[model samples]
Target chain A: MGLHFTNGYVRKKRLQIILLQMQHIIALTVLFHHSYQSKGEHLRMTNHSAPTLNELVSGVVDRLKSAGPLYYLLLLITLSLVIASAVIGLLAMFRGHEHYYNVTREIPWGILISTYVFFVVTSTGLCLVSSIGHVFGVQDFMPIAKRSVFLSIATILSGFFVIAFEIKIPWRMAIYNVISPNLTSNIWWMGTLYGVYLAFMFAEYLFLLMNKHNPAVICGFSGSVAGILAHSNLGAVFGLLMGRPYWQGPYMPIYFIASAMMTGCAVIIMFHILGYKINGEKMDGDMERALEVTTKVGIMLICVILFFTTWKLIAGAAGQPNGAYPVVMSEVAGHHAFSFWFWEILLGMVGPLVLFILSKGRNLKIMLIASISMIIGIFVMRFNLVYLGQSLPVYYDLGVNEFKEMLTYSPSIYEIIIAAGGFGMTAFFFLLGEKVFDGHKVEHH
Target chain B: MNKMDFNKLQNEGVENVPMQQRRDFLKMGLAITGIFAGGTLLSAASTFNKAQAADFAKKYPYSPHYSMVMRQDRCIDCERCMEACVATNHVPNVHGAYRTTILEKDTSDAIGSTKEFIPVLCNQCNLPQCTRVCPTKATYKDKTTGIVMMDIKKCIGCLTCQEGCPYNARYFNEEKKAVDKCNFCIDTRLARGEKDTACAHACPAGVRVFGDLSRQDSEVFKTVHQIEKAVWVLRPEAGTRPNVFYTKG
Candidate 1:
C-alpha cells in the first residue's frame, strides 16, 4: 500500500530499499536460527531430513544474491508494476470505477475478467498435468510435478489478485460468500471450490517440501479433483447463461476441462525448461522424458481442441442460427476475424502444434518458443471469448437502432495496467519461488 | 378464396401486425393453421386454438401478483413514462442506465403504422434469472407481490445478474455501488398506497395498464385472459415466465 512515492523517488531509492530488505531478511534468518537451534526444535524429521526453516531462508538469500543481474532486473520491474497496479486498484475503489475503467452499463465486464479466466485456466491445467505424474504415479510425469504444483499456486493467486479489483465490493463478497452462500449460483460454487483447491495445493506443497510422500499424494489428488470442479463451474458461469446464446449449453464446461488440460501441458513444458535455465542446471534424462510425454499430450489435446472448434464454428454458422449466427459471423468475417485466425487459431493452436512436432519434445528451445507462442495466443483467446459473447446486444434480434449492431469495448489504461500487474505478480512469485525452492527439485521415491 | 394466390397478397411484416389481426386475416375463408417456412407459407389443418388457458396461468401463485399489460399499438414514443420513472425512482441521468425506456422499430412495410414504439421494463418474472444466478441473495422476488427487489447492501456488483437477465433491464448504480433495477415502485409509491406505477400513471395514451393479476376482475388479468386479442411477452423463448404482458387493441 506504500506504492505512492513519486517516480523519481522510486528510481533513486529502489536499489537502497532492495538492499535494506535483503539485510533485514538475513538478520531475521540469523536470529531465527539462533533461537530455534538453541532450543533444539526439530520441526519435522524425515529420513532425508528436509532443509530446516533457517537453512531454507539463508539459502534463498544466497540464491537471490548469486542470481544473474537479469533476474534482479526482471524482479525489480515486475515488483514496481505490481506496486503501481495496487495504487491504481485502490484509486478505482475510492474514485469510482467509471473514471478509471471502460466498463459501461451495456458492457460491465472487460479485460480484468478475461485475465482472471486466463490465469485460472492455466492454474487448473497445471494441477491436472502435475497430478498425472505425482498423484497417479506416472513415472514420466513425476519429474515436472513439483514445479508445476508451485506454479499452479502462483497462477491462481494471480487470478485472485485480478478478480479482487474487478468485484466492486470485494470485502462484502468475502464475508457473504461464506455466511450467506447461494447454492444455485455457479460463481459461488466456482469461488468456494477454488478456495478449497488453493488450500489443498498449499498443504500438498508443504508436504512435498517436508518429504512426506503419502500426505503430499493425498493432497495432490484432492487438489486436482477440486481444480477440475472449480474450473468447470467457472465455465458454467458463462455456459449456463440462457441469455448469452454464444456461450450457452453444455459445450463450455466440456471445452473448459479439455482446454485447461491443453493449457496445463503447454505451461508445464515452458516453466520446467525456464526453471532449469534460471538455476543454470542442465536438463536431466528424466526431466527431458517428462517434457517429451507432456509434449505428446499437448499434441493430442491440440487435435481435440481443433475438432471442438471446427464443430463450434459449424454449429454457429450453418443455416445462420438465431442467436449464435451473428456472433459467429462477426468472429469469422467481421470485427474479430483477425483475432480468431491469427491468435486463437494460428499462434495458439497451429503454431504451437507445428513447433512442438518439430522439437520432437527433445529440443527445449523449440518447445519453449512454442509454449511462449501458445501462452500469448491463449491470453488473446480468453479475451476474445469474454468480449465476443458480450458484443451482441441482448435486443439485437428486435432490430432497434441501439441494439441492432454489435457493441464494441476496449480496455482503458487503468484496466491494462491492472491486467499487466496480474502478469507481474505471477512472474515475481515464480522468480522468488525458483530460488527459494531450489528450482523445485523432486527427490525420487 | 379457395386455392388463393399467396404471392398476390402484399407481405405485411409481422413486426407491426398483432397476432389477432393475422388470425382475423386467416379467418377470411382461408382457415390457415399456421405460418411456416419463416412466415412465407401458410398451412391449414385447424391448429388454431382460441383459448390459451393452459399456456396462460389458471391459478395465480402470488396474492397481489402485481403485473402490467402494455397496449403496444398505442405507444407514440411520448417518453413521458420514462420521465415519470426517472423522477419516481431517482434514476441517474446517464446513457444506457434507465428503469424504463422505449424501443422504436421501423415497420415501413406494415399494413398499419410505418413505425412502432414499445415500452420495456424488468418483467419481474415468476422465475427470475437475476435472483437465481445472484452469488448472494442481493436481488430476489417479493413473496407477497412477486416484485423483484434488491438489497443494496448484499450486492457485490459482479454484474453477473446483468449478464443473466434476458431483458437487459438491470444496470449498476454508481452511487449505490450496487446493481439496480425496476422494483415496480414498491419502495417509492406502492408502499405509500399508490395503486399504479409511475410509468403507468403518467401514460396518456392508456398504453400501460398496471394491476394485480390475481383478481379475475383486474384489467391485467382480463387483458391477458381475453381471446379477442393475442397477448404476448417479449422473448418468450427465454422462458422466464414473465409477469408482464403486451397486446394491441
Candidate 2:
C-alpha cells in the first residue's frame, strides 16, 4: 500500500511540471508573434511613400472614428473662438487699435501680450527639453523628442497668431523686421531670431520625419541655439526696461529660462500621456522610462523656479523699490494675492512638485492631475508677471491723481477672444499632429 | 577738540579739520561727484546717435541744441499752453493724449496754501531709452536740433517707446497709428524755422524759457549751468539727464 501511494505522488509531480513548461512555451510564442507582426508592419511602412495622401486620409478617418462627442465639442468650441478672434482682429486692423483693445499709454501691454509670452515660452521650453535628447544625445529623453519638437512649432505659431492681433500693424512688422533690423533692440532680435528658430525647427522636424539622422541633429542643434537666443531676448524685452523698476534687472532672463524648462517638462508629460490615451495604446517600458526621467527634470526645474520666485518676492518686498513695491505688495497682500497664493505658489510650484515626488514617476493618473494643474497655474503665472509689472503706475511715487495708486487693466471681450484663439490654434494643430504623425511614434533605435 | 583750520588740518593728516572746512569739503565733494555724473547725464542719449563724437559736451550737439527750462512757480492751470500746442501742432482732443500737459501738485502743507501746476513736455534725455528701444527708428533724436523727433510713417505701434520713457511722455496716436510725444514742436513749428516751441511761445506767464544750450549766451545754458538757485529736474534719480530743467521763481 505504501509503494502504490509513492508512485501516485510522483505521477502528480510530473503532471504539474509539464503544465508549467507549457505555460512558458505559450508566452514565448506570443512574444515571437508580436515581434513578427511589428516587423511586418515596419516593412510595409518602409516600402510605401512616407505617409502618402491616401495614408493621411485613412489615418485621419481612423482618428475620426475613434473620436467621441467630446472631441467634436472641443473642435466646435475651438473653431468658434478662432472665428470670433478673426472678426474682432480684422475690425481692429481695418479701423484702429483703440477701438478694440483697452490698452492705454499707462498700461500698453494687456492680456494678448501675456498670452503670446505664455505660448512662446512653452514652445521654447519644449525645444530645449527635446534638444537635451536629440542634440545632446541623452538616451532617456529621446522618446519625447519628435512630439516635443512638433508641439513646439504648434505653440510658437499660436504665439505668433495672438501677437498678430496685438500688433497694430503686423504687415508693417513683416516688412520692417526683414528690411530694417535694429540690432540693439531686444524686440527686433527676438523677432528675427524666433523666425530663424522656426526655420531650423521646421527643417529638424522634416528630417525627423524622413529619418535623416545627421541632418536632423544639425537642425536640432541650430534650432536650440536660435531658441535660446530668441527666448533670452524675449526676457530682455522686459528686463532691459530702464524705466520700469519692477522689470528692470537680469533676473527676468534667468527666471524665464528656468520657468521654460519647468513648463516644458509639464507639457511633455501631460501631452505624451494624453497622446497615448487618444491612440488607445499602453505606455511601453521605454516610454515609461522617458516620462520618469522627465518627471525628475521637472522636479529639479521646479526647485530652480521656486528659488527664483522666493528671491523675487523678498527683493521686491525689501526696502520697497519705488515702482516695484506697490505691484509686489498687491501680489502679496492685495488684489493679486489670490492668484499669487492659489495659482502660482500652490498649483504652479508646490502642488506639482509634491505630486510628482509622490507619483514616483509611475502613477500616470496622479502625474496627469499634477500636469493639468501646472498648465493652468503657469498660464496664470504669465498673466500675473505681465500684468503685475505694468499694474503699478510708472510714476507711482508722484502721488498725482493720474497715478495715485495702481493702474487697472481688464481684458475686453475682443482681447479675451483673440487670446482664446491662440489656444484654439494650438489645439487644432495638436489634434492634426496626432492624426498626421501617427502619434509621433519613435522608430526602433 | 576739532577746530583746526585747513593748513593745520593738513599738517594733522586732515583728521582734525574744522567743521567750517568740512562744509567746504562737502561742497567740493558734491562738485567733484557732479563733474563725473554730469558727463554721463549729458552724454547718455548721444551714445545712441550714430553721428556724434564720444566727448559730448554738457550742451547738446545739435545746431539749435533746443532746450527748455520751466519756472515751476509761475505755472497756472489755465492750460492755454496746451490749447496753443494743440492748435499749432494739430494735437487731437482726447483724454490722456497730449504732446504736453499740466500736472497739478497739491502742496498746501509744504507750501503755504495752494496747489501748483507743473507744465511738462519731453525732456529729450541725452540717453533716450525710447530711441534705443525702438525696433524701427520711428522715434529718433534729431541730429541737427537735439530734439527727439518721430517718423510716424515708420512706426509699427509696438509701444516700446512708451514703456521705455521714464516720464509718461508717449501716447499712441489713434489717428496716425503711431506713438506721439512732445518733440518740442519739431515737426510742426521747429521745422518751420520757429525760434521757440508752440508751448514756449504761447505761455501767457513767460514760464517756459526755450533756447539753444550750445550757445553760452542762451538763458537755458545759464540757468542749468549755474547752481545758485537750486534748479532741479523731475525724477533725477532716473538719470535721464533731461533737457528740461525746473526752477522755482
Candidate 3:
C-alpha cells in the first residue's frame, strides 16, 4: 500500500512541476509582450502621420482594384495553384502520407523539407540584406529595403504554409510546443524563435507602412536578430546529430548563416529588378545605385560560397574519412557529380559571378539572368544539402543487407505539386503586395 | 583453427549453427566491433578497464536501471523474438518498422562462423538523443523506469527524433501518426508485473538477456561488469551511453 501511494504521489508531483514550468513560460511571454508594447507607445506618439485605418484599407482596395488584365491573369493562375496544392496537401494529411510522399523509414525527409529550408533561407536572407540600409542606416542600401522587407514576410509565410502539410500533426505542435517545451531541442528553439521573428517582421512592415522610422528600425533589428538565431538553430537540427557524419560539427550553422547572406544578395537583386518591371517604372538614380551595390555584394558572396564549397570538399576528401568520404565522393565525382558541377558549382557560383562582373553592376538584363540562374542553382543546393546527409546508411559498415547500400529518395508528384504551391504562394503574395503598396515606394526623409 | 583456411569454410547459413559450439571468440570478439563501420565504434578492449566492476557497484541513476545484454555469437536469426515483439507490441509488418530486429553480418574471413547475427532494439540510453531532440517532450525518458517512453498525443510528427537516433531504432507509425520504438516492454510486460521483455522471453538461443542493472546480482550487471571478454555498444561516439550491450560468451 505504501509503495503504490508513493508511486502515485511522485507521478502526480512531477506532472504538477511540468505544468508549473509551462505556466512560467506563458507568463514570461505575456510580460515580454507588455514590455514591447510600452516601448512602442513612445514611438507611436510620433507617428500620427500615417493614414487612418479606414483610409489605409480603402487605399489598398483601390490599388488592388486598379490592376490591369495581365496582373489579374497572373494572379488567377497563382491562386489556382495555391488552391489545388492545398487540397492535395489536405488529402495527404487525411489519406496518409505513405500514399502521397516518397519519404520512407530510411529517408523520412524529402523534398518538402528541402523546400521549407529554401523558403526560410530566402526569408532570413532578405531580412539580413535589407537591414543593412534601413536598420543600420546605410544610405546606398535604403532604396531596396521596403520591397525586400515585404518579400521576406511573403517568403516566410510560404515556408510555414509548406511545412504545415509536411508536419503530419501540426495542430498538436501548436498546443504541445508551448505546454511541453523541450529546452534542449534545437527544433523547439528554431520553431519558437522563427515565430518571434515573424511577429517582428510583421511589426516592422506595419511601422514602415505608417512612416514611423524609429519603430520600423527597432522592429527590423529585432527581426534580423531573431532570424539569425532561428536559422542557425535550424542548422543545428542537422549538425548536432552525431550519428550523421556528413552534417555533424559547427560547420553547418556557420555555413547556414554565411550562405544565407549570399542568398539574400541574389534574391534582393532578382526581386528589385522584377518589381520595377511589374510597375512599369524606370530605375531612378538611387534605385540604380542600390541595385549596383546589391549586385556587387552578390558577386562577392558567390566567391565566398565557392571558397566554402572547395574547403568542404577538400576536408571531406583529405583522409577518405570513413562515413564522409563516400558521401563527398558521391557529390564530387559520383552519381551526384553532374548536379555538383553544372547546378552547384557552375550555375550557382561561377556563372553568376561571371555574369555580375560582365554587367559591371549596371546592366539590368545581365544581372537579371545571373540572379535567375543563381536562384535555380541554390534551390538544387538546398536539396543536395538535405538529401546527401541521409544518403549513407547509418549502419553501412555492419555489412547488413538492409543498411549496406545508400538510401535514395525522389519527390513524388504530390510532393512536387506541394512544393510548387510554396512558390505559387510567394508569387501571388508578391504580385498583390507590389500593386497594393505601389511598388513599396521609399521617400527620402 | 589457424591451420584451417578461413575463406574455404562453407556458408552453412543459420540451419547448422551448433548449439553447443564454443570458441575462444576473443580474437574475433572485435569482429562485431565492425558495427562501428562508421570509424567511431571504439572497442571496449581499448576503453573498458578492470575498474569496471567498481564502476558497476556504484549506484546507477535509475533505481531499477533496466538494461539488455546481447550475446552476439548465440543468435542464429530464428526471428522468434521479432515475432514475439510484434505480437506483444503491435509492431506493424512494414519493411522498416519493427520493435526489435536481427541484423546479419557476413563473415567470409572469420573462423568457426561464416556469418553472425546481431539483435538490436532501443538502447534506452542514459543520454538518449531521441528524448533530447524531441521538440514537444512527446518522446522522453521515463523518470521512474529509465525507459524511453512516448506520449503519442504530444507528438508533432516531425521525425526529428528519427534523424537524431544513431541506432535506427525509431519508425514513424502511420496508424498512430507518431514515432514508435521499443520501450523495453515497459507498458506491455513490466507494468503488468513481468520481469522480462517479450524479446528476451522469446529468444530461444539466449541471445537477449533483460535485467535490472541496479541490482548487482542481476544477469545484466554480471555480464556487463566482467572484464574477461570485450563488450561494446553501437555508435559509442554518439555519446548516448546506451543501456544495451553486445558481447561474446
Candidate 4:
C-alpha cells in the first residue's frame, strides 16, 4: 500500500513538471511571435501585396489550418488559459480570497502597477508633444503632428488596456469617482483634468478630421493646458508618498514630465522613420528638420534627467536620522547594483545621451540609432524605478520582526505574456490606423 | 440714428411720481395676504424639514464612499490591514494596491528610537478627488453607501486618476488599463452590510474602529465627539474633507 501511494504521488509530480515545461515553451513562442510578427514594417510588408480582404483572411485561416495537430493543440491550450484566467478573475472578485494576490504587507505595490504608470505617463507625454505642434503652432513639428495625435490616442488606449487587467472592481471605480467627487485631492484633480483633456483632444482631432479649423484650435489649446496639469499631478502622486523614501521628493514630478517628453520624441521619430521606409518615400527637408529638433530636445532632456539622478543619489548617500536614505542607497548600490550601474545609468541615460550628442543632430542612420537607444533607455529607467524601489527591507524596531529580509520579484511568464500582448495591441492599432486613415496626411491651408 | 430719436423723445418731457404713492399703488391690496402666506409656510417647515436642505442631505450626505477614517494615535502600525486588504481584494502585486495600510515614521537614530506609526487608508472624503477626474466616470462615489467604486468595463486605462490622488492611494492595473485603490472592502463586506473591513477585524490592538457616522449613535460618531482634539486627517489642506479621521495623543 505504501509503495502504491508513493508511485501515485510520483506520477502526479511528473505531470505537474510537464505542465510547467509546456507553459514555458508556449510563453517563449509568444514572445518570438511578437518580436517578429507584430513589428510594424514586418506586418505591413507581409500583408501589403495580399490582393483582397477575403484572400488575406483565408490565407491566415489556411496557415493556421495547415500547421497540423500540434498547432491546434497549442491553440486549444491558449484558449483554455484565457478562459481559465477570466473565470479565476471573476471568482476572485466574487469570492474575495486573500491568497489571490502576489502582494504582501512588506511590498504593498508590485510590478504590474508600476508598468501601468509607465505606459500612461508615456502616453500623456505623447499627447503633450503632439499638442505642441497642433495647438502651440510649432511649425517645425507640423509634418508629424497629425500622426502624433493618432499615436497619442493609440498609446493612451493601450495604457487603459493594462489597467483593465490589473484592477478588481473596475465598475465600482467608474461609478463612485464621478458621482461622489473630492475637489481637494490631487488624484481627483488629476483624474478630472485628464478626463477633460481627453475630451478636448478627441474634439480637437475630430475637428481636424472634419476640416473645421477654429474649434480644433480652441480645443487643442485648452487640452494642452489641461494635459500639463494632469501630467504634473501624476508626478505629485509619487512625490507626496513621503513614507516611501524612494518616491518622495520634489523632483519626481519634474522627472516624470521630462521623461515623458523624451519618450514622446523617441516614439515620433521611430514611427516617422519606419513609416517613411515602408512607404518607399524619400525623407523631405521638412521631415529631416523635424527629426533634428526632436533629437535636440531629447538630448537636452537626457542631461536634465542625469542631473536629477545624480542629486538623488547624493542625497541618499548623505544619510540623516530617518535611515531611509541609507536604506535606499544600499538597495541601489548593493542589491540592485547591476541594474543601477549597467541598465539604468549607463545604457538608459549616458548611452543615449552620448549617442545623440555624437550624431551631431543630423544623419538619419545615426539619429535612428539614437532614438531607438533612448526608447530602450527610458524603458529600463522605468523598470529600475519600480523594481528597485520595492527591493529594500521594511524593518520594525520591535523584536524579531517577521519581514527582515529584502523582498524579491521576478516577472512571471504569464505576466510577461500579458505585457507582450500589450505591444501586439499597439501594433494592431497602428496597422488599422495606417489602413484606414491614409497615414494621417494633412493638407496645407 | 437710435441716439437722435431717443434725445427727441427724452426732450418731450417726463414727470416723476411721488415715491410713497408709487410704492402704495404697487402694493395694491395683496400685502396682507402675501405676508400671511409667507409666514405660514415658514412656520410649517422646521429647520430639519426644509425641503432643499433635506433633499441635499439625502443626495450628498456628509461622507463620501469607499473611504476609511483612521485614528493615527490608536494605530500600532502592524500592517495587518494592508495584508488583509491584498488578500481579500486579490489586488495584483503592484504599487498602489493597499486599500488600507499602516505607515511607520522614525528618525534616523543609531540607537533606533523615536519611531511613530500611523495607519493610512482612503479618506472617503465628502469631496473625493478620485471621482472628479475620471474621464469615463469609472471612478465614482456610491449614492446610498458613500463608497467610491470602479467600473472596469468603461475604464480606458488613462492613469489620470492615479496622478490626481494626493495620498498615493490610487494605482493603475497595467494589464487591464484601469485605475485601482482601496474601496474599503465595500464589495465584499460592506455591500453585504458587514460592520467593518478585514483590517478592522484583524487588528489586535483594538486601535481601528469602523462605523457609519451617518448614524449619530455609532462608535465613529462617539469617538469623533469624545476625542475631538486628538483627531487629524492626512493632508487636510488638500480640501478633500476626508471621511477617514485619525486621533493622535
Best by TM-score: 1
Per-candidate DockQ vs. reference: 0.60, 0.43, 0.56, 0.03
TM-score to true structure, per model? 0.87, 0.85, 0.86, 0.57
User: Residue A256 error for model 2, in Å?
Assistant: 0.9
Candidate 3, residues B102-209: lDDT per residue as tens digits? 998886877666888889889898888898889999999888778999999999999999898888899988888899999999899999999899999998899899
Best lDDT among the predictions, by candidate number = 1
Residue-level lDDT for A217 in candidate 2: 97
Query: Candidate 3: where is the Cα deviation over 4 Å?
Result: A1-62, B1-42, B45-59
lDDT of 1 by residue, B1-249 (tens): 545777578887788999898767856434222222312221111111233445334335788999999998899999999999999999988776798999998867554447888899999998888888899888898889899999999899899999999899999888888888999999899999999999999999999999998887999878877555556777766767788888777
Candidate 1 lDDT, tens digit per residue, A330-438?
Answer: 9999999999999999999999999999999999999999999999999999999999889988888878766888999999999999999999999998898787666
Cα distance off (Å), candidate 1, residue A288:
0.7
> How badly does each model clash, as a count of residue pairs?
0, 3, 0, 73
Ranking by lDDT: 1, 3, 2, 4
C-alpha lDDT of candidate 3 relative to the true structure: 0.85
Off by over 4 Å in 1: A1-54, B1-59
Second chain only: TM-score per model?
0.79, 0.76, 0.80, 0.68
Q: Which candidate do you rate higher for lDDT, 1 or 4?
A: 1
TM-score of chain A of each: 0.90, 0.88, 0.87, 0.75
Which regions of candidate 2 are displaced past 4 Å?
Answer: A1-44, A47-56, B1-59
- Residue A207 Cα positional deviation in candidate 4, in Å, after optimal superposition: 3.1
**Candidate with maximal DockQ:** 1
Q: Which ten residues in a row have the lowest lDDT in candidate 1 chain A?
A: A31-40
Say which docking band candidate 1 falls in: medium
